[model samples]
Target chain A: MRRVLVIEDDPKDMAITRNAVLRAGLFPDCVATGEEALSYLLRNDCAYILVEPCVKGLNLPLILSLANKRDRKAAIVVITKDSSLTSERKLREMGILYYMVKPADDMELSMVLQNGKAD
Target chain B: MEKPISILLVDDEADFRAIISDHLEEKGYQVFSVGSGQEAISAAQEQDFDVALLDVKMPGMDGVNLLQMLKEIDPSVEVIMLTGHATIETAVQSIKLGALDYLSKPVRLSELEVTIARALEVRHLRRQAFQLRERLRQKEAFPEIIGKSRKILAIQQQIEQVAQTDATVLIEGESGSGKELVAKAIHRRSKRGDGPFIVLNCGALQESLLENELFGHEKGAFTGASTEKRGLVEVADGGTLFVDEVAEMSLACQTRFLRILEAGDYRRLGSTKDLKVDLRIIAATNKKLAERAKQGQFREDLFYRLNVFRIVVPPLRERKEDIPILIGHFLANSEVGPKPPPPVSPEALESLMDYSWPGNVREVANVVERTLIVSQGLPIRPQHLNLTSREVPLVTCGEKDLLPLEQVERDHIQKVLAAVSGNKRRAARILGISLRNLYRKLEHYGLANSEPLKTAL
Candidate 1:
C-alpha cells in the first residue's frame, strides 16, 4: 500500500510502470510532466520517485530542489530512454541510485522496490 | 569417496617424497607427493591437504616461496619446513612466512609423525575458529530483544547474573514477550557462547517425537528410525538447550528428560550405548509452572529443578514506554530490504501506545509490518493499522474449555488440517507428527473415510 511516484510521458510506458508498482504492492501516482509531478509532491509523500529523463519539459533541477527538502525527500530512480554515459553520471551525481535504460525489466523494478529507502 | 586427513610431501628428491608419502599412508593418511613447488601449487588447487611437508632446497621454487604460495591457495593448510641446510636465519624466515615449524632433513620418523600430529591439531582448532568467526559475522535470524524499561532492565540484569553459572533457568512470560530472546542472551553471555544454541518447542511435537528429537535414536531403534541419529542434546554438547513451552512437555517425555537431568546420561532410543552430553538447560513457558505442578499437570520435582534461576519477562502493555522504540525497530527491519523510515503519524503512535497488547511484543511487530506494507512511503495513519482483532487468539482450548483427551486430539488435528487446506504433509510438519500418525488419527476420528485426500495450496 506504499505510494510511488511515476513520471512518464508515454501512456504505454506509464501503464507498464504503474502495473509494476502495483505488483510490488505499492500505489502508483502517475504524472505526465515534471510540473504536475512537483505539484503532486507538494501535497503527497512518496517512498520512491520514478522519473523518465527524456520526458518533455522535465525540469531535473527543479524536481531535485523540491525533493531535497528533508520532509518531502524520496529515493529518486531514473528510467531513461537515453543510455548516454554522461546522462547516467549526471544522475548518479544527483544521488539517483538506479538508472535503468529503456525497457527496464521486472527484476530491476523489484530491486528498486526492495532497496529504495531515502535517507 | 571422501578422503581422510591428507598430507602433501613436496621435495626436490623423489626418494624423500616417496618415503614420506608411503610412511604417511601407512599411518592412515591420504598422501599427495610432488617434486617441485609449481606441482605442489597446482595439486593444492585440486584438493585441500591438512598438512604440507616442504623441502627448503628445491630446484625451481624454494620451500619458503612454496609455503607463501600454498598459504594463498588454501589458507587453512598447515605447513612444516624440512631442510638439509638448517640455518637459524632460514628457519626463522620459513616460520615468518607461515610455516608451522622447521625441521632438519635428518629428522627421525617418530619425530616427523609427532610434528604432523601437532600440525593437524593446530589446523583443527584454527578451522573451528574460522567457522565460528564466519557464523559470528552474520546476524542471528531472530531479532534482538529491545527495551530500556525497568522491567526489561531487571531481566537483563538477571540474564547477566545467571549466565555466570550453568544452572537451569526458567523464564516465565506471556506468549511473544521474548522468552526465547532472553534465553539467547543468556547463552551468548554464558561460557558456552561459542557452542551451539539448540531450541525446541515442546508444544509443537507429540510425546514420542519430542523424546526422539531430544534423545535421538539408534538405527533399528524403532520401525522407521532407519539410520542412527544425533538428537538436540548431543548437538548442544557444551552449549545451551532452550525448551520453549516446557509446560506442554508430556508426562512420558518429562520422565525421560528427568533421567537426563539427574544422571547426565542417556541411551539412544533403540540402543543401549550410554551417551553423555554437557549442556545448560533453559526452559521457558507462558504458564504458571508452580500452579501446574500444584494441579498435578506438571511434575513437582522437574519444576523445582528448572526453577534454579527464575526470570519473568513483563508483557508489552506493562512496559508501554518500549513500544515506540520497538515500532521503529520493526519498521527498519521489515524484511531483507532497506531500512524503512519510521513515519508513523502522531495520532497513529498515540493509538498504538494506548492499545492493550494482549499478544505482547509479537503482535505489535505483526501490526508494524502490516501497517508499513499498507502505508508504503506515506506517513502511517491510525486507520492503516487495521487493529480490529482485539483479543489474543488461542492456539489450543483454554483449561476451562478442555474436552476429553480423544476429543482434544481430534479437534487439534482438524484445526491443523483446515489450516493447511487439507494438505497432509504440511499439517504433519506443523503438528510435529509423522504422516502415518496423521492418517491413524484421521481413521480414528472416522474422517479419512469421509474426506478423501486432496491437494491444496
Candidate 2:
C-alpha cells in the first residue's frame, strides 16, 4: 500500500482530506505546520506528498530541497486556492508532480491520486 | 385666534412696571420684571427671553439708548418701548433704534404680547434657513471618487479621454483592483451616459450559461426556459457592456463573442433572428491575456479586439503613495459614528505600505474596514493588521548533498518532530506524508522503538 501525507494547518481541511482519502480506500497521515512536515518526511518513506499553499515555515524552497535528495522520484501534489495557468507552470517548474485548486471535491482528489499511481 | 406671549419688563419705576407686568402676566403670559436696563441686558443674556419692555422715561439710560444696547446683546430680543408721555420724534427715534413697537401712556398688555409672538416666529424661520445652506455645502465637497491620490487622478483623466471615444477598452489588473469602478466611470462620462451599463463576469458561469446570459434565450430554449428573456447584450444596447475576467471565457465562447464584436450583431439562443446592438465593449482581466493567448488558452484575435484602448491599473504595492489618501477617503466616508477611531499611527501606515498586497485595492479596503471594526476607537496598530510577514531563508546545498533520500527525510522529520515535541502525526502531516508511511520510515530508519516515536503516536 502506497502511503500518502497531507501537509495542512487548518484542522477541518485536514479532516476533510483524510476522509476523502479514506473514502478512496487509503489511509493518510496529517500534520499542522511546515516545520513538523519536514521532520516527518526525514523519518518516513512516503510514496506521495500533498501540500497546501499556506503551509507556514515550509515553502517551495524546502520542498525542492527534499525532492533534490536521493529519492527524487517521489511525487508531490500542491493544493492552492487560485486556479491559474501561471501558478500551475510555476509549480511544475519547481518539480511538483501535480497541482489542484482547493474546495476540490472528492472526485477530483481521487482522480489526482489515481493519476499519481499511473505516473 | 391668538395666544398670549411671555415678556421681560425692565424699568426704574417699580410701581408702574410691576402693575403693567402683573396685568400682562395675568393674561396667560409669563413676564420677568427687572429694575434697570443693565439688569435687563444681564437677564436677556442668561436666558432665551422672547420680549423685553423698557420704560421710555428711565433715569440713566432711557428707552432709546437701552433699546440700542439691548438689540446688540440679543438680536432676537423684541423690545416694546413704554412711554407715559409720547412724542412723534421720540417714538420715531425709538422705532428707528430697533424697538418692536411704542406705546403711549400706560402700555396695552394685549398689544405687547402680540408683537413678542411675531418676533419669535421670525427668529425660528431664520435658524431653519441657515441650517439648510450648511447641508448643501457639505455634499459638494465630497463627490463620488473616494481617493485623493495622483494615481486616481491619472486614472480619472484616462477615463475622461476614453469615454468620449467608441473604442473598446481592456482594463488589466489584479483581482479587487476596482476594475468595475473604472468601467462605470467611462460609462458615466460617455456619450451614452443616459443609456444602460451592464456587466457580466465571464469566469463566473459555464459556457452555455454565459452564452444565454450574454444573448437572450427564446422561450423553450432549454429545460428550465419558462419564458422569453432578453440577454445582457440586447439590454445594454446604446450603452456600454463590461465583461469582467474576459480571459476566463471558453475558446468557443470567444469565437462567438468575437464575431458579435466584428459584426455588431448577435442571435438569441434557439432563435435565428439577428439582433443588432449599438453597444460599447469594455473588458477587464487579472490574468496576463497575452501569455494565455500564446499558450493557446485564449484567442489572439479576441484579445486584440478588446485591447484597442488599454488601461493597466497598478497594484497596491506599486502605488504605496496612495495608501494614506485611500485610508483618509475611507475614513471620511465611513458611517461609523459622530466620532471615529484615532488616526492610523505612522508605524502602522509604514507597515501597510511595506506589505505586498496580492489582493490589491479591494484587499486594502477590506483590511481598513476590519481594522475599524476591531480596533473600536483605538489607533490601528501593526498587530491589528493580521498580515503575515514573509521571510525567505537562504540555504546552500553542495555536491556532498547527494545524501540518501531516506536520510534527508529522516533528518528533516527528526528536526520537525523535535520542534513539535515528538508529535508523529503532526510531523507526518507537515512532511506531506501519510502516518503509515511515517511509521514505515520510522521502522526503516531503525527508530521504531524510540521513546520519542512512542510518545508522538
Which structure among the candidates has the greatest DockQ? Answer: 2
Worst 10 residues of 1 chain B by lDDT: B136-145
For each candidate, what TM-score against the reference?
Answer: 0.47, 0.46
True contacts kept of 1: 0.00
TM-score for chain A, candidates 1 onward in order: 0.91, 0.82
**Tens digit of per-residue lDDT, candidate 1, span B366-425:** 787678777776788988888755344337867887679998887778777777778899
DockQ-based CAPRI category assigned to the predicted complex of candidate 1: incorrect
Error of 2 at A87 (Å): 41
Task: Quote the positional error of residue A80 for candidate 1 in Å.
Answer: 48
| Candidate 2 lDDT by residue in tens digits, B8-67 | 888888788778777777776778888877787788788766778788887777778888
